[model samples]
Target: MTDAFYDSHCRVQAEKMNDLAVSDPKQLVALSEQRYEAQIRNVCSYICNNMERSHIVLLAGPSASGKTTTAHKFRKMLKEEFYVNSYVVSLDDFYIDQCRLPTLPDGSKDLETVYALDIDCIHQCFDQLTNTRRASLPTFDFHTASRSIITNDITLGDHEILIVEGIHALNPLITEGLDASKFFRLFISVKGEYSLNNEVVLTHEDLRFIRRCVRDYYHRDSSLERTTGMWASVRAGEKKYISPYKCYANLTIDSLILYEPCIFHHFLCPLIEQMDPKCDIYPRFERLYHILQYFAEFDRHYVSEDSLLREFID
Candidate 1:
């Protein structure tokens, strides 16, 4: 069953923010921070309650959904509030060697498929971690598009939590041999949108796309055009592989930061404006630009370095 907490929380938050005076950007930023912090605290409370019975956490989210940042924040909350340490295992590191990965008809690696991961190795590592509290974690080299020879030795403390996060963490194939009782599953995504006059102005997908575009431009050296071009494939992969398993999560997190669109406007507008008129992605760029016009710009300086927005906005 899908957890109703996040959906309810989003509805309440939207109402609260909408009721606020839109005249002051400072007030909006403060309110956004308050909502974001409360949501984080709620997630931490849920984790603490399950700490005694669950040692493993499987955190799954779609692209630009702030999975990495959420993992970091969860770790921080565990340390500060519960006095527990945690180990993070990235599923991206468990990808099968490039040569063995499944290829699309176009001869490109179909990296989105869960079969691209080395299932046997993951099961073995999880077995070692649960049985002996020790495991060697493999690291994937994105540049080389393969698993690296070097590995990190991780030993989980008696009170420590182990978090495994990726786009496919909730996939049955990855958790095939694992004990469901030993783990807590979480599904996160941007589940809110900006609306005006009963019309949806910006959708959750558009928000995530903005995040991905900003992050891709600065961190991955991907141009706005390239990010927009790849969006269809990303959404297709999510529909086929990710969305079906969302309801399996013990909890769901809405990763939307209400003030994000305003912040994104500062970073994304230039890139959107630069899109070639003749390019196929120009229409999407135009649509996003038009939607952004409804939001009042907020200063990014108010956002902390550790904020979830950092995962996408650099």
Candidate 2:
């Protein structure tokens, strides 16, 4: 879909969120739950209808687009609806060794590029899984920035599905020789924004940025400063590799939860407060903090532990 389509969709959803926040605050949790369940059911239906012919499912999206959680949820729903087995293979586990990664003009490792991964090995694994229904997959240790010595032996059972998720999963290079009909492609992203007093307070990318910052700090032990520093490179990689292949997806999911910003405020406020005023990203942090002022704080208790929002917060 075009940017205009998503912009309109986000606008309507933002308005709905505002109305719900004012009219029935207690129902926000239920509304969010229903919306999430509907999307899961929609994906499950697509898989059920196509299960006979599709063997591989490629789910790609930008950073912090809820890809991992979506894959897990889709797998759960598929098992419930069809009683079939599925394996989720993370492309992240195939990252090339740090020393061998391509260097950018500024001498920084360009980890976001598809070439940062071992494409030949990935192609072979895909071939093995599809033909022999089994393959040995490498596991990457993000902390050490190297591939682990141990590999996972993944096997697909009869009538099973193989889900490969990563930022570049839909890139043509990953499935070059595979039949297009044997694959189901999905592109998931946050496509909504919140407006206040007729002024746009946040954009779709802003929501994703917030998610990334929180997730990086809490889960990856990355500082906000480091996360902010890497964002430009991340967006550049998305533009070069991910965005161009979006049209190849058979389905697109907007992974935004309307109450996300409110929930994020609790975690981000303290982090933003800790930033030094003179730091390069302090101004950006201040702006984000200001935006949160327009949103009401949401109680974490209202959110289910399994919610996609949990992928980033708590």
Candidate 3:
């Protein structure tokens, strides 16, 4: 979609968020959910329209933009609506083990860039999948920080789509020597900024941070200290490596659900309230705590189990 359309929707959603918070909070939740579902359908339609232009989709998004859920949902919609079968693969499984991770000039590990991955292996899998219609993909164990046992070879059925999703999926290095026509490049992001009385309360960055914090703490067993501490480097990596490559995307999806903050505030506020003031990450959490209060929370159980918000809150 055009920048104009995205900006326009951001403004409209912000206004709707503020108004619906008071007049009809329930409607706000339903409408926001509907908007997000429609956006996913629109993305599927776009891909369907250009089916000939692409079969291999490279999907990427920054942390907590719901890239994983989006891919799964997109895959589901493509099958349910269009009767297309697809397979989704992640770059995390392709990372070289932490012990063997590449280092910088100062000898510190450089884990942020694409080079940290088994690039040749990725190319091999992609090449094999496209040419031979099958390849065995590896799995990575985050707890062990190493590649797991290899899985059985997977085959791409005739006329089926293959989706690769990760932060670096759009990087030119991954696409080197690949045919552009057979590949569709898709990127996910949150472009909305929620405001109140003409003052901005939540930014696109803040939305992602909140998502990561909730997911990190509740789902990943990560403390606020760890999540906040790593956020700076994570954002720096996105700016340097991910956003720069978005211009090459066939479509960049704005994955913001305007009502997400409503649900998030319920879970995040209690955690923030318990944060130790003397902690190093307290200041960062304090800022978000202030922003979270602006949102009028609703019953989180009201949300669908399969909702994209579940990616963060589950």
Candidate 4:
């Protein structure tokens, strides 16, 4: 049986828990943080301890689900016992340039689909990494509008680990004949644990939508309207390309927390305020404003500017 905490109708029970302790909201926040951290450590330990040989641990996740951040944390833990050398291979870096990629039914660029990546090149990189002692990785330059495979070689001795985190890492085409024992798989998703006044539950996709909106505005030089507009297509691509392969993973990490939205609100609310009142996003702005009202205020005074959350909020 599914834990009551994770049930599909968990929102109603969560509300009951909220009402039962309405006088001590801090207790819920603290307990949620503890659960979140424990989940991170548990996932990391499972991967590091369960592997029997040198294998490419495939960490696949939807966008802004803290895949990159969690990879960093997991590497830190692995280093305590093994001479681990980790490299983050972003699928975004492997994207076929906009000009060369496939066109949508409307003639616009299909930026979110697997067709945007050079799958053959990706297969080559994995083959090289697994077969040879030394390999050079490719780096994609989004700003310059080009890609050049890095020719410098990296040699990994024993007691080393290679972690590849991306949208398609679990896709069979990426690593076809590799032994199952040689490759451990993980699927990560930003399944939000927050709710609307402990009533209307927030879905995992909702958290990702907010994370993408914050990330696109800050890093990709995209506007809230543009990110919100493209989200449906991005989500469709995930359903088609990413979700089907999730069953293949050995582990699934729920990168959700009750506190993150509260933390996110601190940074994202002000940016939403800057949107033009006359724009189409005004209605969304109202919804975002309503959400902000529910969270107890977070003082971002402690949040580091270099933090991954900064990638979204800044």
Cα RMSD, each candidate: 3.6, 3.2, 2.9, 3.9
How high is the lDDT of residue 116 in model 1?
89
lDDT (0-100) at residue 113 of candidate 2?
Answer: 91
Top lDDT hit: 2
How does each model score on TM-score?
A: 0.91, 0.92, 0.91, 0.82
Which residue segments of model 2 deviate by more than 4 Å? 1-19, 22-26
Q: What does candidate 3's lDDT look like per residue over 1-314, in tens digits?
A: 12222343345334546556667776666766777888888888888787765678899889988899999998999999988888888988899999999886768787778888898988888888767778998888888999988664678776688888999999988878766566788899998887665567788898899899899999999988888878877888899989899998888788888788878889889998998899878887898888877766778876877788988887
lDDT of 1 by residue, 107-213 (tens): 98787888888889888888887778889989999889888989978888778889899999988877687776777889999988766654567788888989999
lDDT of 3: 0.81
At residue 312, give the lDDT of candidate 1: 81
Q: Kindly state the number of residue pairs that clash in model 4.
A: 0
| Error at 260, model 2, angstroms | 0.5
What are the runs in model 4 whose C-alpha is more than 4 Å off? 1-34, 81-83, 196-198, 273-278, 302-311
In model 4, what are the clashing residue pairs, if there are any?
none
- Model 2 / residue 56 / CA error / Å: 1.1
Ranking by lDDT: 2, 3, 1, 4
Predicted structure 2, TM vs. truth:
0.92
